[model samples]
Target: MMRNLLTLLFPVLCLAQGTNYNFKEAELKARELVFTQPDSALVIIKKTLANSAGAHDTIKGNTYHLYGLYYNMKGMTDSAIYYYKKSLPYIDNYPKIILRPYINISASYRNKGEYETSLKYLNDALTVTKKDNNKTGEAMLYGEMASNYNYMRQYEKSVDLLLKAIAILKTEKKTKQLYAIKQKLANTYLGMENFNFAIDLYKECLPGFKEIGAEKNYYLTYINIGEAYIRLNNLQEAKKALKIAVDGLKKFDDKELIGITYSKIGNIENLERNRESALKNYKKSLDLLLEVKSLWTLRIAGEYIDILNQMGRYSEAQAIINKTAPFQKNTKLNMVDRVVYEKAIAETYSKTNDSKAISAYKNTITLMDSISSAEKEDAVKEIQAKFQTDLQREKNVVLAAKNNALTKAMKAEKKLLYLYIIMSISFIVLILLYLRSYLFKNKLQQEQIKAVESEKALLQQQHLHELELNNAQKEIIEEKERELTSTTLQMANYQDSITQILEKCDLGEITKVSELKKELQHLIKQKDYWRQFETRFNSIHPEFNQKLGNKFSKLTKNDLEFCSLLKLNLSNKEIASLLQISHESAITKKYRIKKKMQITDDDEFEKILSEI
Candidate 1:
């Protein structure tokens, strides 16, 4: 899951110095790199901080804040908390500035599963922001607290906090943040299964996403809208929305998301009783998901198998079951899907008059019984939750009444205090006038100190960035080498296994014809094994296909596969066996591939493929 809506925060740099140290410029550069090149950003921040030993507290604090964001990005929650806390004392005087660290620390704690501790820090930040009347910070803190509540499974509290956040954003006319919060609120309602509310909020947020040109988010919102419509039994609208989502998702090249979009469209078609269309979409979804090895395939497989069984495509359904059996074996498949698969297995066995039909039926019954019990237990928990939510709301109402009374009383007290302040204003002004020169001198000294620190920071930024970039690049290269070594071993093992099969067939050590036929059929079904290898290769060298395509657009898919095998350093015989071809044929194909790329004798094809 994406990190719960912790809006990416960068430190605010307001340096006014014209000196060469340029702390603000260093900060600006780091902020730009932090999201895309975090290690380099950290280098800049550390160098700026080290050179700023005698600088203004604010500069040091901003560096610490950047450090927090860097660690958070890396998912080092404890380190993030440490850095955020280190910046607190320096920035606490600026409520808007100080609240950021508090909220960040809360997010770190929430991510660590310490929800109560996260809430404590969030409440502290909330108080500070409210005292400062900083609406933006208040809304941000509210949003963070809402995420924490959502983590705690306190959905009611999460919704309430989100509403409070939305209210603040709307009142402040913060259109960007307002719509973002609205989206979150809609998702919260989705979690609560309040489809109408979710759809309403999603519709409200859609225009803002478009206005911001957030195509991905807009597509995602359409997805949510489609899901809501599906739940409402509005299949026509669901199809329209999901089709748009799929079209939009294709632009981003996120295979898993594209698969999910297809799966959802399959659901829409299934609901419309368009069996053939549903099967086609589901098969397409399963293919893409299998390519990515997405966990979602388990859920879709259950539906796909059920549909195949209904259509009397028993062999295809059994093939899918066997293909996904490994995932079902090791992973906690959802109970509903597991039962669906079990029932389909029972039906398949019944058609064959197999004894396993009885066992499959029993398994399905037992699994369904367990699901029923779980649902009952969940129902009881829901009741308990409702009771607690009601009590909490009552308490909130009482607290609001008390706050209203306190506001009235404070207003009266403020009026009296103002009268007294007015009477003493002339004397206070005369005292301030006498001390003005002293304060002016101190301000000048502070500016001089800041200028010196800024100059030092400016000098260190570039050198540190270069040093960090080289180190980061070295680490990346070593990591890739290790990955390549592992993949090469797996491919070698697969090739050896294929060679073993061929040798076994050749020797015919008392093998019957029926056994040989079964073995060949099993081998044919084991194409998924090679597909797994291809998936892993793609992950390690994501740019491989794209690079090959760009260079040799006419390269056949088989040729591209040949290039991947070559990159793994497979020998001609091994590649031939894996690709189900003769050694001479593999060599001819390699020549053709090389010729298409115009590679001469001096060119190292393997080395060139490996680089991609």
Candidate 2:
């Protein structure tokens, strides 16, 4: 009887005392919950912290990391970094976990403009990651480091580093990471004045981004590539890419990114001599950017100021400049600001033809020229100090911890239990929901993310009223890239469409035909696709094709595919690749189309579409 009673008491005590249970499941669950149900995750972190007040290092680390993630979700980056560091020592034996902490800290510092320091941490994180063969961590750290370099205008370093990261991600088959790295690499090339490479990379990254539903990045890539094309005087390509960005805005909600998109589109339109459209997009960009207090975008507002000055709306432009000046000053002079703002101001002065402003412009040029060096030095000093300070402070924590109670542990445990139960229940629910919802939510989030692009679209009108002295127009490098991207995407799409048509012809199987058609259908389902094409065509005007269809009113899908060849107007050799046929096959198809339309060898059918 005594033994039976003892057994019952043991279980009761265990329940009250809490077993370790590996907690991996809990930790994973918590991470999944962090974004989907942040509030719930917060409660769980609180409960877990309470339940395991002085638990093992692993348990404690999990609890702290969860809290850190919760804070990150709230935009409390400082608190998130703090908690992440708190989790660091506990996971010291596990460098893999330590790697994550450094990555988080690096990101926080980056947003804080502590780039040099951010770089150091990423380097350290890189070392840890190699030991553990943590491919994801390595890829992320490389990206983070590259971005820091980008901010410093060390485009070469940024590109080299990001390329290495991209290679690793590709080797690991990490599609998301590869997509991110590719997009970032595109930016680096854009900055480096390699428009062709920038455009090509952005085009390469698009499919993966679409598959993952990373809409913000997609819009950003589109805008960046478009701007590059415009720089290269490829107005058609620039217009096409910008149009994609404009259309993308309708599906996204992040105002800031949208604002950037709009600003880009406006600038493209301005170059196209569609002043009215340009004005509309600039206004959209400015309004959204202002809402978020974006300094990078404030420079874009300066573009509008230049335009206004060109139109002789000096007073209005001056007023708008005055309004944005304080906001720009308040932006705290990060590396990006130092470079973009000074260059813009100098250009603005030059465009306004103010001889008196020449002195100011020269000074501005001096600042722009030296900003990168200064930014790098500042970044280094800040991080070097932070590392030393944090290391010293940790020593203090070790000394202070000696004063705490091991004797009153049971009572502490009991108190922890109540905290755990309450917090865990709330957190678990949230985590499950986050895990369940992440795929759906990320997909649905496309619209929310694209909102930033919409805001970017409207900045043109604002530009006319407030910024007639624009300098970004001379910011030609990035624009050239967008045009290149449009060209590449157009070709890639043709290749795929041709392959599809060829597959249907070769197999002639009911199932194969159905599958090929289905695949084509899916591609068109993406708003990016031109319906008549095999894949998503970036340069061709889908609506133009649609209008032609309306006029004809009876074109078959194959006929449309045949018309798609009109896009490139490639020779029979080129058309064969687009249609998945031999050159002879392509020529025969062309002849058949000619016969159907009652056309002769005298007239080129591709040229006819241009008239339509």
Candidate 3:
């Protein structure tokens, strides 16, 4: 998608060629004007040339190069080439200066559709850059050459050069250039309709752009991802990525990109049969496109006309067709777009029951048939060519494997012959040595058997000890759980007695109510009872209280008590009776415990406590 925002050709600023006459400041000033004020840029370059006249050819050469760069930015290819050629005579004195002129002139020629000449200049630049061992420069040359090949429709060659450039950029650690080169490679993959590879490359480079805060590139990467998803018929994911791109691009003045993003979203909606949303997004896209007067707006218009006709709004669709008629002839609509326009017009005509509707339908059919025939022919050729290539590659692989086998066989044969010679020489010595070796081997085997038996006995003893230790631990845990259960039952009984005494005191069953109140108060202050219960619970589930406190530092003493009761797996009714509270309060306390621990409904709170 960033292809729509073509890379702006700018001058590459470098230090002055020689120490004779430095004009870096003036060149910087001139370059700043090249894009916004080309006339002023020309003036600055002319002034620099005049002032530096009779100076070293290096100074004059750079001025002439700036002039060429200025004209190239202004789209004056002939004048740019003239100035670029004028600087060539000074290359011997300033070798690096030759690179800029060559590169700029190539780009200029490329803009003029003179790809052959452009490639020649690029090749010359490559030779110079290679001789200088400038990896970054060479990488740039490869990218430029790739772009020229891309224009020539030799996509495979373009992809090859782009890969070479990416390798060089990686070695140079030129991150920005690497991003651009990889993006171009991804776009080439897109042209080949290799959507998955394109998406992978886009995702690979996305983080680099995001890390550097390259907003334009970051959003454009999303747009490209969206386009890939659209091609793969993944409408939901396509809508997501395109919507993100639109939101990010809306913050900037990139209307064209924003419009394209909306158009893609509209296409998704249209495919999903969301007619209302489709119309809304299409109109938004058209409005933005109209502000920029982009040629691509006609394509959106054509699609919009179809949606309108589908909705039975024939007059509205006709109105749009009328408005688009003038632009249709001037704008070079692609075959697919022309097909859409023809179908829309034919559909509108058919709604009116016109005789011309038959002719229009026939024309649309003929165009479709011709396009289908060409596509089928191309597909057949591509398949046949691919099969041949695969066959040849397979043969080469098999032959190479055979050669490798033969080479290995020859080496093995040489080794075998050498071994035979050695064996003959040592035949008598080997017989004497073999008897001595056999006696030593017999002793070694007997020692190894004894060691093996010792190790086996040691492992059995260790396993028996581990089993004993496990049984002992299990018994200890079960004993502690029994102690805890007995203590809980006692506490529950004591609590029930206290409740009965309080109830009798309230009901005047105890005539000495003051004495009964004092006894009930003493029973209620059962600190020692709770302390005993906590000690036994900890012994059963060690670290339960300490871990709950450590994990939830804000948990109060009451919360710890609640967790301890849960650790012992006490029923809520038993806990309520033990605490002398209603069952409802116990449930409320449990809810509070869950909230404090941030436990979810799906999490087993008791299980978590037991693990801790």
Candidate 3 vs. true structure, TM-score: 0.43
* Ten-residue stretch with the least lDDT total in model 1: 1-10
The 10 consecutive residues of candidate 2 with the worst lDDT sum are 1-10
- List clash counts for every candidate, in order: 4, 68, 0
Q: Which candidate would rank higher by TM-score, 1 or 2?
A: 2
| Per-residue lDDT over 1-612 for candidate 1, one digit per residue giving the tens place of the 0 to 100 score | 112222334445555344346787888787656544668888999888767755667787878988887776554567778999999888878776677678778867765557788899989988887898888878877788777766545688989988888888788887777766777778778867899999999999888777654456678789889999999999999889999998976654556667888888988888788989999999888888777666567778878887887888888887887887776663334566666667667667655445556566666666656765756566545544543454444455545656677778988899999999887997798889879977998999999999999988987897799999999987986687567656555555666766777788789752777877776676666545556667767776788988888887889887887888787677888777667678999889988888888885625776678677
Residue pairs of candidate 3 with colliding backbone atoms:
none
Ranking by lDDT: 1, 3, 2
Instruction: Name the lDDT value of residue 224 in candidate 1.
Output: 89
Give RMSD (Å) of candidate 1 vs. truth: 41.1
Off by over 4 Å in 1: 1-8, 11-158, 167-173, 191-193, 329-612
lDDT of 2 by residue, 138-251 (tens): 877788788888866778789888888878878887766676777777778887789998899889988876665445456667888888998798988887887787677444
Q: Each model's TM-score?
A: 0.42, 0.46, 0.43
Model 1 accuracy (lDDT, Cα): 0.74
Residue by residue across 1-612, what tens digits does model 3's lDDT show? 121112222333444443454467777677556544557878888877766745656666767877776665443458779998888887644445577778778866775557889999989888878888878778878888887777655798999999899898888887766776777788778767899999999988888676544566678889989999999999899889998888876544456678888888988999999999998998888887777655566678878888988899988877776766665564234445566666677667656444445555554555556556645556545544544454454455545666678779989999999999999879978988998999999999999999999999999999999999999999989888878888888978887887788788788888795888688788877756777988777667767778889988878989898878877778889889988889999999999888877886725787787788
